[model samples]
Target chain A: MVDSVIQTKDLTKKYGEFVAVDGLNLEVQAGEVFGLLGPNGAGKTTTILMILGLTEPTAGSVRVLGLDPARQPLSVKSRVGYLPDQVGFYDELTARENLTYIARLNGIPDSQIDRRVDEALARVGLEKVAYKRAGTFSRGMRQRLGLADVLVKQPQLIIMDEPTSGLDPEASHEFLEMILDLKKEGITILLSSHLLYQVQAVCDRVGLFSQGKMVLEGTVENLAQRVLGGAYRVLVDVESVQPEIAQALEKIPGVAHVQVTDTKKYQVEAAHDIRPEAAQAVISAGGRLLGLGVQAQSLDDIYTAYFQGGSI
Target chain B: MTEAMAQKPAMPDERAVAALREREGSPWTGIWSVILKEMADHLSSTRIFILEVLILLAALGTVYVASQNIQQTTAEDQFLYLRLFTTAQQPLPAFVGLLAFFIPLVAIALVFDAINGEFSRRTMSRILAQPIYRDALLMGKFLAALFTLALVCTAIWLLIFGLGILRLGVAPGGEEVGRGLLFLVATIFYGGIWLALGLVFSVVFRQSATAALASIAVWLFFTVFWGMIAGVAAQTLSPIRIGLPDEFLAQANMELALSRFSPNTLYAETMVALLRPEIRSLGILLPTQLEGAILGAPLPLSQSLLLVWPQMTGLVAASILLFALGYVLFQRQEIRA
Candidate 1:
């Protein structure tokens, strides 16, 4: 069995009368990239803070790397690297100096600090600009430097909060690719982001958060199956749609629902890939099949479906 | 015997479990790193560099004028070396007066944004996420600022002494040096109160500008308006209704007590007793109480220190109290924003 690197049981946090995180039970297995998906102010950052022991939980317990964070913060913190949202560094210090300072704070030996900083910066693709001051870095570059800062400690578990927020599309793609590389190295990662589609490429599993609660948790595909009532969304464009075509597509085995989305396009939600059967139904109803393909279930559909009062 | 043998292994297991439950590592683990980093920042900052130059110019100008004045007048005084700090030339205050006015500014500048700057720059969470406890960060900033103030004060002291020896052509007495060293300590503590005040405001206010303004406002209050307010308060509290000696004494003591609430007043009293050894008491003394006392004889170094011990303690206590307040505030603040 894989080890659970992070485990929280009924973890909760409250600020005055407002409950920021309410009785959250979360677990992330080793070597898997877990995304905490939520809109802004959904208590994702609060949960991360409790796990890192930066803020005390109002109730419940959290263990990171098999150590209680509140009791063994130093040990947990040394092992679990965290990149806060809008992460910042000493702007006056060069990238190397910034990483070196964090390395020192983590108690990395002086003999290995330079090498570690160089390796971390190289890993983040920041070696060319290592001598430049952090203040001059762009938003994407600063995010990468934040990643380099985390990598300097060589942590067993890395937690990032809104790591890709406010980045251009290309930079966010490159950053997610880097995360996938870290996952290949068998490092457990937990990242939070409101941009669900951006995290979809790297996250192996995700927990959807709403109003300080984990509304749903599983693989994206699994969530799609559970929430959308199907694992596949097939779109069929017919040259001409007859009144019986919609009924014929619904009659196909494994097809769950059929909706006439436009003049000649039909959206078919199904339990499985019924693309072949769907094409046959369109053609047999005296209509020509123009195109038929399986639409990959993006997390956005599942998120909107879940929050739009759709049946779970 | 078998039961005891079985329990022996369990004892070590329980001990291991207890060890695991306890928090790992010392809170001071990265304190030295924080202190070194902050000290480097203070030493290299342009703001502090400018302040250092301003203070150096003030020290040189005041000490030069003072040494010249001492040479012309009071050349026969035995404690002419000590007079370098207290002697005021026309249109210029004494060196101690300058210190009392400028030390707070330097101290405030050093720490006005110490904590909030971290938040504004968004580095507080990242640094707090390190292995060290918050105690190390706050204390490191405080000690770094205090040490920087000490370094500046000591440099100015040595410069004044050098200037005194060069102009007066006489070495300072052993007693003068001791009193001077005590005065240096008092000066640092006086700066410490302002440093701690800046730190507290930094913890309280998120904007560095607001913290700086708040600290300077408190300093201005103490330096300018505290004495007048104390006079009015004491007159109202202990009015001289009958115009008796006792009423006068009561009002004087009351005024002194109220003025001591400000660090400026406490610092001023401390400087007077430490620099002028002939001072017998800081409080009002009836003539009948001093009838047979030797008029111009200087008290021993220890007695002068004893005379101002309360004032010195007041400065130290205020610094500690303000620092503790900041520590508590910083500890309670949520690291998230």
Candidate 2:
């Protein structure tokens, strides 16, 4: 029942001989955080620009919120907010003035402008600094102000290009929390970043981009299973080694593979949590289980393995 | 719950759907917002404040000296008000002459960084993301700069007139006032040409300093060397062979035409025709052609305007051409930054 907020069909953008965004089909459903994970020069920003109708694609098409971005750009832009990388503001204007300018550009009624700007600023924890010149604020403060700028538009969807790229760890964490808060209000968020761990922390689904193309996409856990066979690595140590124990562990319903790392230790892989089943199987196979634990794989490990394996 | 939700078609909110179905407004929407914002920036910037002060001082000094000299030398002249603008007192040029120099500087200062400054500040993409067309942004900046130029020129014009009336104890004739207003309009469009030129460079160059330097370089070439270049070009194109009268006239006409290509020449010509109406022709006048002419008799305001119609149109056309060039360059530019 989820509506597709953004749907692109074979969208491609080229600058002379160099292709910036290859023919790509991307779909983002309503109310979910979709992360576009890619290294620099991987065409994430180009894709965002095309979706916002800021740049024309060389071929194919884009639809955002049921409107063709190229044909109905005003409609698309008014409803979808974009926070560009290293978002900038007028150094001379105060934070309130900056947000007020954006609100007016969005055609918010004069009577509602003050209310909307104040509400957005307060939402980003920037109300205290609202009267200060943006140039005087710290980098992290500017990013928050950028989020406030987007919120003033009351957008149905928000697109951010590397929103957390240049922030301290605490600031980035705070920004992600604000994004999660927006998600709680049923606002669909599409953010691009090369920081895998951050994306994994916030995105419900993610697409891996390489050289202007989406090489793989899905939930982080699903991608982990697809690439690593199984991400749940359960390590088992038994007092006695038995061939029957390995066979029994492999019989678990969700188990994908098993390997003997030592004379008395076994590494069991499963699509999902099967640690209890693994323990039962090891004991029933006439092996005395001494220790058992699981090592959860992270998105960084998944991304590294995915690229190092040259799966593209 | 999931099965039930999957089977049923979710109906979109009626009001929300209707809002989306409403026809989008004209591409010019929010253009005023942009213009107001830019105009505020131009009027408040320290650079403009200094330029305004420089212009004011120049106006006060020139008009004061010109009025004092006019009182001493031409107290009985019928066009004493017009004299305030054109009479040069030693070591200082007339107000109109000063305008010929300062107009372009003020215009260039207003707009040399209009577009590229947005990129350098990293605000271009964010602003373009608003629910407005690129046309609005470009046109809005142009009109704002034009308006700013007009405001400054009008203020100086009024100041000169006020000083003229106060010092000379005489009111300007209706025709004199009308001519003065036309002079002000010409001054604005003269500035408009440079504003548009600066905009073109701003669009072409990503660095504000480069755009500023390029605009000033073009202005310097036109102001300092264009007249000489026009003469040399006319000599090459239409040589005055054997010293025939017709050939001399042809070379003169060709040179005038070539010089008019520079906005400085056009603006200067327009100012002469408007401020000093006694002049019968802007080109070589044969004795035979002036057989019945009354020397030194100022023509009616309408005839003077007719004489400078081409020059005035040339100023406007140059501004429009440059603005169109900037618009095309900006529309093609990528907003990635």
Which parts of model 1 have CA positions greater than 4 angstroms off?
Answer: B1-22, B73-75
Error of 1 at A129 (Å): 2.0
Residue B122 accuracy (lDDT) in model 2: 98
**Ten contiguous residues with the weakest lDDT in model 1 chain A:** A255-264
Kindly list the per-residue Cα lDDT of model 1 for residues B276-320, writing each as its tens digit: 888999999989989999987899999999999999999999999
Clashing pairs in 1: none
Task: Residues A1-312, candidate 1: write the lDDT tens digits.
Answer: 239999998998999999999999999999999999988899999999999999999988887888878878898889988999999989888999888888988999999999999999999999999999999999999999999999999999999999998999999999999999999999999999989888788999999998899989999999989988899999999877678899899899888888888566899999999998888888888788889978988999999989896446
- Say which candidate scores most in DockQ: 1
How far off is residue B151 in model 2, in Å?
A: 0.8
Candidate 2: tens digits of C-alpha lDDT, residues B1-337: 9988865654444543674575466878899999999999999999999999999999999999989988875556878888889989789999889889999999999999999999999999999999999999999999999999899889988989999889988888999999999999999999999999999999999999999999999999999999999999999999987999889889999999999899999999999999998987888788999999999999999999999999999999999998999999999999989
- Assess each model's interface with DockQ, reporting 2 decimals per model: 0.60, 0.44
Error of 1 at A248 (Å): 0.8
Model 2: per-residue Cα lDDT over A208-264, one tens digit each? 998999999999988988888887989999987789999999999988888898566
Q: How many residue pairs clash in each candidate?
A: 0, 0
